[model samples]
Target: MAGSSATGLATLLPGAAEAAQKGVLTGFDLARRQGFPMLRHGPFGLIANPTSVDATGVHIADILHETAGVPLAAMFGPEHGFRGSAQAGKSEARSRDARTGLPVFDIYAKSGDALTAIFRAAGIGCVVFDIQDVGVRFYTYISTLFDSLVACARLGYEMIVLDRPNPITGLDCAGPVMQPGYESFIGRAAIPIRHGMTVGELARLFNAAFVPALAGRPARLRVVGMQGWSRDMWYDRTGLIWVPPSPNMPSLETAIVYPGTCLFEGTTLSVGRGTTMPFAYLGGPEVDGAAWVAALRRRALPGCVFRETYFTPGFSRHAGETIMGLELIVTDRQAFAPIPTALTMLSDALRLAGKPFWSDGGRTFDLLAGDGDTRAMLERGVAPERIVAGWQPALDRFRARRSGYLLYS
Candidate 1:
């Protein structure tokens, strides 16, 4: 059944074979070429953000609004809001888009019946989702995707996902899968931390595997798959321009390390949120930069090097205070294992701190890691390699389960 569904999905993508012969073409680009037949289900609301733009840097909302016969009636913003004006854990208040004058709804941190009510209030027949995902499990965009799918499933609204590349190549599936009871917006479903799949592929997986259980039936979902994208190509290799998916995720470099370093958010350490480097920089007010660097270097983790550095973040965590730590530079992305690298860093930091490293009694860390076991093991001075090794069986199962949903070769 799954194989047939996969084949059906592949057939739905027009020009997919021809697209592979050319340059990378996003699902939105292909949909535009087809005159957006999806929009024929009129008065569709868009759930998008800054990253929802085309090859030419034009925002999809603007393009659809200008296109005659396209019923781009409403807009919805996720974590950072529609225009991306809000900071982390916050979203823009409900307002009208100045450009399109369309009503904008806030969907961040919202789920279940509340989310369904918002969709019902929009008076739209269908929902269009087109946000660029960085391919990490905890990134809120994917959470928004899951919640929106649940709401759509309940409301019987079809969701057309305009897919984009997983900025970090969709090849390596690493880190721990979220446990049953530890579900949060950061991880609504049980997938690995580094889920090596695109948004469209994930949409398919969610629709078939998870949504039926949550919404009592799968959402009506169609993924407009990308053309010319494969499992091994990274975002920089794609010709598309980089738009910061969120204020903190500034570049491809940041996206590369994000799957691991983002776990720092659960700790006392700063993930360099306000700094120019963001996830590339890790530090805290009390960290010993030289000692941390030496410890990391001793591990000699693959495909990366560390430089002792200091910086005063302009905003989140240690804001206006000079932090002592290191800048992680990935020398070879192919060999780099972000999850293990971060675990090593975390273990070393915990040893050096002489204090509790976790915030909120390590609950947040456990939530991000997808279980309390990881935190308990790290606290017990377990080796990062051993912790990573423990995850392999589960990771293998996840890879097998997700194989049918992969769109690229």
Candidate 2:
């Protein structure tokens, strides 16, 4: 009842309320207390996007160039372009940054010789990655960071990571580990679906795991961490700006539903792209929203609710056609786990359809879930609760292994 009196967390966990407010810190804020003084005269290339801003909305790249004279040699664009213009599955090629006046290279798809060439051409002594990650493994910004670190190692450049909050708390790691063969651009490493580690914490893990693969051999790594960040805090608690990392991820509300709804992307259901709502709505042309919501309501999944509705997406999957689906309302983010929520919905939806209700691609859910286990469980008529229970052992093992690399508790 101590934290609960003023914070209203009396029944909730001790730190639950504070954790909700503190999200990822902005790069400009990080620079003030971080080792930014040294970068004032150093040659540097910024690996960042529009989200790398100060608390008051000052862009980090502009701040570094105008004030510090760090010589912004090359601007490395992540999944989204330097200005956050590109879409999913594609990276913006070389383009002129209107604000920074620097050559923005596309590192979204660059690798091996191409990556080596980018650094060699820029000839900068240090490479700094300051992009924001949604704290989910499927979100690809962290993968871009990993690839850049690999490049820095190979090119013998000083790799300094400016720390940001994980947006999600770093305390909870959930979902199945990325098995060996399922690794793709979306998942470059064997981390959980919700990795819960900040980009800096992940950088520390990379230094330990792939020391041999680092380009220059040894990890020439340095991390400038935040002063007030804690492992218990989530994004909203950080008092940082919430810039949508991509087009589909419209808000933290949408992101709360994404971990599960995203698996629908590999299927025929419309995961609500191209419309203003984005991931907030999920439905397909053949879906019966009323029936689906009614069925899901019976399950009474914790911390979430479903609103039966009909929608038409402008593009992406079921474009321009009215479809019935369910809208996920996450009333309690702390108690809601998107992975389990999604699995339950997907299983229920499949069963309700009855006529083999999947889109043309059978078992495509396997790819999205990163293995056949989830799909097989769904197919074998296993409920969502059982499916989650099945993966607990693997998840536990991964947590034990990842414990060594954890920078924060």
Candidate with the greatest TM-score versus the true structure: 1
* Alpha-carbon deviation at 301 in model 2, angstroms: 0.2
Model 2: per-residue Cα lDDT over 71-175, one tens digit each: 678788878687888877777888878876888888886766788788778868878888777888778888777777777777777777777777767777777
TM-score on alpha carbons, each prediction: 0.97, 0.88
After superposition, candidate 1 runs with Cα above 4 Å error = 1-3, 6-11
Give the per-residue lDDT digits (tens) of candidate 1, residues 1-409.
Answer: 1234421133246555676456899989989988988788678999999999988889999999999999998999999899999988999999999999999999998999899999999999899999999999999999999998888889988888998999899899999999999999889999999999999989888888888888888887888878888789999988889999999888999999999998988898888888899988898855687999999999999999999888778777788888878999999999998999999999998888856688888989988999888989999999888999999999999999999888788
- The residue pairs found clashing in candidate 1 are none
For residue 89, give model 1's deviation from the true position in Å: 1.2
lDDT of 2: 0.73
In model 2, the worst 10-residue window by lDDT is 4-13
Report how far off residue 358 is in candidate 1 (Å): 0.6
Worst 10 residues of 1 by lDDT: 1-10
